[model samples]
Target: MEIEIATIGGFEEVGRQMTAVRAGEDVVVFDMGLNLSQVLIHDNVETEQMHSLDLIDMGAIPDDRVMSDLEGDVQAIVPTHGHLDHIGAISKLAHRYNAPVVATPYTIELVKQQVKGENKFSVDNDLVKMDAGGTMSIGPQCELEFVNVSHSVIDAINPVLHTPEGSVVYGLDKRIDHNPVIGDPIDMERFREIGREDNGVLCYIEDCTNAGHKGRTPSESVARTHLKDTLQSIEDYDGGIVATTFSSHIARVKSLVEFAEEIGRKPVLLGRSMEKYSGTAERLDFVEFPGDLGMYGHRKSVDRTFKRIMKEGKEKFLPVVTGHQGEPRAMLTRMARGETPFELDDGDKVIFSARVIPEPTNEGQRYQAERLLKMQGARIYDEIHVSGHLREEGHYQMLDALQPQHVIPGHQDLQGFAPYVDLAESQGYAVGRDLHVTRNGNMITLVE
Candidate 1:
């Protein structure tokens, strides 16, 4: 059998992730993602209301034009997680392929919510639910399994596609976390078993997002410690405390809520995305949200909640809002710009529980948000978080454990790919032979 894989997106850049694997006539596509930087850059333009093709042309969604020929051959559209960059484009693009979208339960529900919320586009494709550690048949000769992996977002998985040729592991944006707070730890034994199979893993399409950095990615528990230390230091402050982070980070949000409760403050989750993700976690029993915790889903409701908090006593409540990356429309950014009902006092703290993604648009928006908050005399505490992607040491651990026949460094540009190649080479994997480095729209074919 001859197996071929195409890097539709996320091979040369950080966003707009989609990859296609072809075993015989069956094709499976993974991660129809959005380029948030591009989306934010083009926000408010007429193109915002355009179709998927237009959005792809504008660089907001994946370039599925590369898979136009195999649209009918697609077996499933699988998303590895719930991150917008992983599942955001499904509403716009999944309808093109007449295949069921198979994903974790949280991801499926989140996609449903996104589709219902996106008035401009609708997906007619079937939505199938799968959980971590579940297996399903995508084709007569292709079996897919979701191996649980730890990441910033909940329900992230490392998908392994077993074909007649061999098993291919899609291991993007994952880190080995032994001490996760919300989910189970990384399944190293499963990966090791796959590596020891006779056919084993033919190609390991791995995440290299942070491969340029050294050392293992810190566990989420470390982040919890950091957050506790920072928030506890300000427990005695009479002013208000406002925090912002990725809404999909349920573990971090849980930690924030617990800390707020411990400090004798009511935790209020504000913003639509915040409600969407945290509410999902609640329904799925992943996290037991405090019953008294106030959550506002709409703009009007958020404004009302903020006003009530202001009227009651801002110091008595901890407000967690969206816009850690400082999207102009997000609640935190609106608060920073004085567009919201809340005020930032001279000593009020704004805790950023996320690291800046370092994309050009993110850097600009974060910089502007911080500047405005500074103008309002708000104290800022940023980078009080850990990355979801693996660092060099974690990558080394994964490579040694998986022991695939070939390795493909993904989710990085030429500069980002350099250190990834160095690490893989250090593992005795040769370039252009056992280890391959390619860009988007390129194909890597293996015959068995």
Candidate 2:
């Protein structure tokens, strides 16, 4: 049997993650994602109006012309989670393939939503839902399995491809979170089991997003506790307070809503993405919120809600909004710019439950948003969050658990892969031998 892997995208940057693994006559692709930073860098760029090739030229979507190099039938197009960087390009590219889009239920729903809003392409790919602990046949000699993992988003999985040559485990975008707030823990137990199962993991692809950082990434519960403490400390303040985070982070949003009530404030979710993700989660029964918890997405409804919050007195509510990274059109930026009905007074608090994404564009935008908020006399509370990726020690732990024959560093550029390479070398894996450092649109043949 011949086995090969393609590093399609996201090898040169933090977003637009797409990879394909070909096992003999069958191929399975993982994550047809969009480079959100690439799209956001341009002003007034409507992705809906743009074509895939044009977006690919702008580095917004994966240039999948390299797929022709792999001679196999694509059996499945799997997205590990619903994050934009993982599933954003599905509507644009999935229609080009003849495979079914297989994913966990939440991710499948998210894909449907993305496909719904797309107008340029007709994505008529079949959708298949599988649980985290489920398995399906890829071809005559291979199987696909999904292992539960902890990430910033809910219902994330690490997909493993089983073949006669060996097992190829796609370990992208996860942390060793044992006590993740909303879902099951990072299934290190299953990973250890897979390491000892059958051919014992031929190639292990890793997410190196935080490999340079020391120690392990903290559990989501730690951030929840920090949020509780922060809100409790400011309990007595009789002024408006606002908080923001990744709307896809259902656990963090639930924590904020809980703590807001604990501090005698009615927490209301405001913003389009916030309403979309939270509403989906609630409808899917992944979470339950207070009966009266308001989630307004449309401009008119959000504006109406803001008016209600203002009319009911700013001190009575906690607005958990969008724009954690200060995206120009997000609700928090609009609030900071004083374009919303909500007013900021001296000593008013603004809590950032997300760390600044380490990109020049995001840094600049966040700085400008903070300056605007501060100018409005809002006290900024920042960095009250934890990363969704594994740190140095966590990488050490994963290496010990998987113990694969080959290792591949992914989800970061060459410089980002450097720290992980050093860390892998410390564990006795060399750069050009068993350890492979690769880039986008490249292929590695493990067997032939």
Candidate 3:
């Protein structure tokens, strides 16, 4: 049996996450994602209003070139989670290989809503929902299993692909959050079980997003404290209280809702992306916000909802909207630019429960939004947020737990993965042998 793996994208970069795994004639592709930086840099596409196909057409993201190269040999395409950086490209390219797109239920629903909003009909790829601990057969030569893990989002997992030669474990973009608000914690027992199996893991692809940080990622519970403290610090205001955060951050939203409840106000959701992602989470039983909360999933609906809320007295409701990165078309930016009917009143609170995404386009847009918010006499709260990725000590712990024959870093550049390389060296794993540093489009083979 011949085992071959290639980084279609997202090897030495932060986004456009795709990887092809093949053994004998059966092949499986993981995470056909879009590069947010590439899209913004090349075509000036904003994340909130991004259309996947447009990025593909402009050469801003990868097409189906990787799967197409395998001809009809591809058996399945899987996304480990629902984050845009992991599953954004599935709708644009999953049909090319005519393979099943397997994932947890929430991830599938989120992808479908994203595709539908783009006015694109669903593709032919079958979406099969697999439970966290269940296994599914991709073909005669490959079996796929989802091992539950914790991250910022619900239903996140590390996929273990059992092939003819050996197993390949994909551990990209995860954290070991023990006190997650939405779901259960990481199943370390199952992970150790896989690590100790006879065939074991021939290769392990791990996330290097926080390789530079020196410790385990702080829990979502810590972020909840920050958000709650920020909200409590604000003085009593009679006007609207608006917040902007990552649309997929259901935990943050839950915390905000709890704060709103404590402040004797109803929570209203604005912006299409925010409502869509939140709806998927709710449907999967991930969060349990109050039923009285109102949500607007369309631009026109959001505008009308804001007008009604203003007319009825804004203090009665706490609005959580989009534009965390200041995408111009999102609700917050439109409000800031006076394109929407809603106006920020004096003493009103506009909280940004996220960080600036450190990209040129995002920097410019965020700057514009802040200026406009100040001009409108709104009190702005910024950086009341925390990261979702693991840090250096966390990486060390994961490496120690799932001791594999080889490690390949994902979702980072060479400079970003340097700390991980050092950690591996200290653990007696040398470069080019047990530690594999590869770039995008490079293929590596595992031999027994």
Candidate 4:
């Protein structure tokens, strides 16, 4: 039996995540995503008029040319979660293969919404829903399994491929959170069981975005505590209370809603992505918000809603908007610029339930947004959040739990992956041997 892998993108940089794994002759693709920085750079370009190839050339989407040779051998395209960084390119690239696009229900719902209003391209294959812990046989020699994992997004999973040679697990974006607010914690028991399989795991490919950090990542529960503390400290303020974060973060959204109710403020969700993910969460029964909560998706509706908030006094409403990364067109950035009817007074509070993504593009965008908010006398409370990636100690624990034969560190550049390499080496794996180090477009082959 033979297995080969390709890291198409999201290897040296942080986005456009695509990976092709082939067991025997059957091939499976994971995470067709977008490069946020590149997408932001071409912000004014109309995607509907651009060909997929042009976007690929512009670095907006993953270049699938690495798998050109296996064009007809592809079996499936699977996205681990609903984040655009994991599923954005599906509508643009899933048409390249006749394979089904399989993912959890929430992810499927989000993808359907993404491709709904566009005539640029359509999904040529069926959208199959496989909940966590479900398994599907891809071919006579290979099977796919979804192991539940916790991350910023709900219903995220670690996809594992079982082949005649051994099982290869793709855990690119997850953290071990025992107290995730909306979903069950990391399925460590399943991980340990896979580790003890007779064949064991052939290779464990994992995310190393936080390998340099020490200790485990704080749980969503901890972030809820911090948010509560911050909000309580500023509860007596006489102006608007606006909170912004990743719209796909259902756990954080739920926490914010609960906090809003606790402080006697009506919860009003504003922005497109906010309504998208929150609606999915409600439909899937992943979270339950108050029935009377106000939500708006379209621009006109958001404008009308904010206008009413301004009329009724901003202190009476807890408004949640997009642009946590300070994206130029996000709702929060527009509000900072007085594009919305709502205004931020000198003592008004703006809670950022997120940390800066740390990429240069994100850093610059955030600086400008904060500068604008400060100039308006808005009290900025940033970084009142917990990361959704496993820290160094958590990485060590995951390695210990899933004692795979070989380790492949991904989702980071060389500097970010170094700590993961050291951790795997400490566990007796050898670099360039059992512990493989690779970059985008590079293929690694293993045979048994």
Candidate 5:
């Protein structure tokens, strides 16, 4: 059986991650994602109403036209997680392929929500729910397995395709988190077992987002502790305190909610995304929030909640909102601009429990948001968080564990792939031999 891999999208950048593995006549695609920064760069771009070709033209979503060249039946469209970068394109593009979208429960629920919000395309693809450590047959010659992994979001997994030639590991975005806050740790034992199997790992396609960073990526528990310490220090501040983070980060939100209660503040979930993600997590039994906790998504409801917070004393409530990256329309940005009912008084505290994404667009927008908040006498607490991507030392450990015959650096651009390339070379993987540094819409034949 022949094996071929397609570097569809996200090979050149950190977002819009899509990759396909063809094991003989059966093909499985991983992560039909979106480059959110591309869409955000444009003013008032409503992707929900946009067409797939238009999104592709704008480079916001994967240009999957290259899929025609790969001759195989798509057995599954598997999204590794629920992050927009991993599953945002599903509603737009999955209708084109006659395959089910398989993912963990949380990711499947998020995908369902994303599909319902679509206006241009009617994505009726079956949403299959599979848990971590589950296995399913693909075609007749292959099996698909999900290895539980730890990341910024809950219920993330690295999908593996087992074939006659060997095992193809679709290792996109994850960190080596042994002590997580919400989910199980990264399954290194499973990875080592796969590495020592009879066929071993044929190829390892990795996320190189933080490959340039020197040490290992810290655990989500570290960020949880950091957030607790920050909130506790301001326990006695009689002014308002607002917090923001990735809406998909259920673990972080849980921590914020717990610590807010500990510090004598009622934590309220504000913003559309904050309500959508957290409410979904709570509804799905992935998280358990206090019965009195409030989640307000609509503008009117959020404004009403803010008014109540004002009436009840701002010092008694902690509002966790969206816009950690300073999105123009997110709740935090609205608060910073004074467009919302909540007013920032002198010495008011605003905590960003997330890092600014390294894109120029996000950095500029975040800087502007911070400036506006500071102008209103808001004190900013930034970067009380740890990254979700593996760093240099983690890459060395992965290579040692998997020992794949082919290594492809992904989730980064040419400049970002440089550090990982040098690191792979040190491990005796040569360029064009075993280690491949590629771009979008390219194909590499591993066996024929």
Candidate 6:
């Protein structure tokens, strides 16, 4: 048996993540994602309409070609997590391959929610939900194993595929968070066991997002302290207290919710993305926010909710809305632009519980929003956020644990993946033979 690996996307750049592994006649695809930077740069498409390939072509999705060669031989489409950069392209592109989409429960639910609004391209692919530590056979030559791992989201795992030729592990987005606020810590023992098993890892595709950053990533606990400190310094105000962050960031959301509760206020969530992701986390039994929290998906519904909350007053509620990156269509941008019914009052708190994504459009849009909020006399609290990816020391630990024959860097460009190459070399792994740095559209074949 022989194995061939190809980078359909997410090789030379950061988003539109797709990778294909072909063993014999069957091929398994991992992560059909969107390039948020490319999307904004080329198409000028709204974030909500990014699922369409036409808009994607205009720059919303990565420019790499989908694996048309595996259209019929595709066995499964596995998404490692729920981030938009991983599963966003599946509903739009997976149907062509006619394969089952496999993921942890929350990732599946989140993907379903994303495609639900698109009448033209509703998600109809077969869904197989495998819990962490579970294994599922896909074909005669391959079995997929979900190894429980920790990330910003619950039920995130590393996908280990046992193939006829050898085993391949996909470690796209993971962190060794010893103190993850919402879920259990990383399963180091399980990873070690897998490494020792027969057909032990032939190739390990790993995330390179934090390869350049030094040391282990700071835990969610550190972020919680920062949030608490920021809140304590602010005086109580009469206007709405709004906070915007990554929807899948359950730990950050939990911190905000707890802070709101401490201040004698109810936390109200707004926007469909926020509600859907939060619901997925709750359904997966990750965290339990209060049942009284409100979420508005439609404009009409949001307008009504805003009116009710305005009458009830700011002291009664803490509003958590979308548009942390200042996407124009997101709820926070609409409110900042005076498009939403929600009113901004003097000395009101608007906490940006996220970092500004460095893409040019995101920076511009966020700048506009900050100016508007300031003009309205709102007090802005920015940069109360933490990264979820593992840094250099964490990557070294994973490399030490899963000492595979070869390492293929993923999720970032050459500059981002360089550190991984350096790390492997320091461990005596040769650059060309044992270390493979791939680009989009390139393929690597392993022979035994």
What global local distance difference test value does model 3 have?
Answer: 0.80
* Candidate 1 Cα misplacement greater than 4 A, ranges: 45-48, 69-72
Model 6 ranges with Cα > 4 A deviation? 41-56, 62-72, 121-123, 235-239
CA lDDT of each candidate?
0.88, 0.94, 0.80, 0.88, 0.95, 0.80
Give a tens-digit lDDT track for model 3, residues 1-448: 7787877777767777888888777888888887765665554445445555567665445655545454238877889888877887776667567688888888888777656654343576778888899898867767899999887777888899987656899997788788877788888888888877768888889888888887688788888998888877763677788888999889899899889888777888888888888877877777877887787888888888888888888888888999988786788998888888787877688999988865567888899889998898988889887777888888887777778888888888888889889988898888888788898777787762
What CA RMSD would candidate 4 show? 1.3
| Distance from true location, Cα of 425 in model 6, Å | 2.2
lDDT of 1 by residue, 215-329 (tens): 8899999999999999999999988999998999999999999999888889999999999899988998889988888888899999999899999999899999999998988
Best by lDDT: 5
| TM-score, prediction 1 | 0.97
Q: After superposition, how far is residue 349 of candidate 4 from its true place, in Å?
A: 0.7
Residue 377 of candidate 4: its Cα lDDT?
93
> Clash pairs of candidate 1?
none
TM-score of 5: 0.99
lDDT of 6 at 202: 83
Estimate candidate 5's alpha-carbon lDDT, on a 0 to 1 scale: 0.95
lDDT of 3 at 391: 86
Q: Which run of 10 residues does model 1 get worst, by summed lDDT?
A: 42-51
- Between candidates 4 and 5, the one scoring higher on lDDT is 5
> How well does each candidate superpose onto the true structure, as a TM-score?
0.97, 0.99, 0.92, 0.98, 0.99, 0.91
* Residue 392, model 5, lDDT: 97
For candidate 4, write residues 1-448 as lDDT tens digits: 7788888888888788999988878899999988878878755876655678988998878888889755238888999999888888887888878899999999988888866744688666788999999999988878999999999999999999998777899987998998888889899999999988869798899899999898889899999999999888877876789999999999999999999888878889999989989988997899988888877899999999988998988879999999899899999999989898888888778889999997998999999999999999988999989888889999998888888888888888888889989888888999989888888888887773
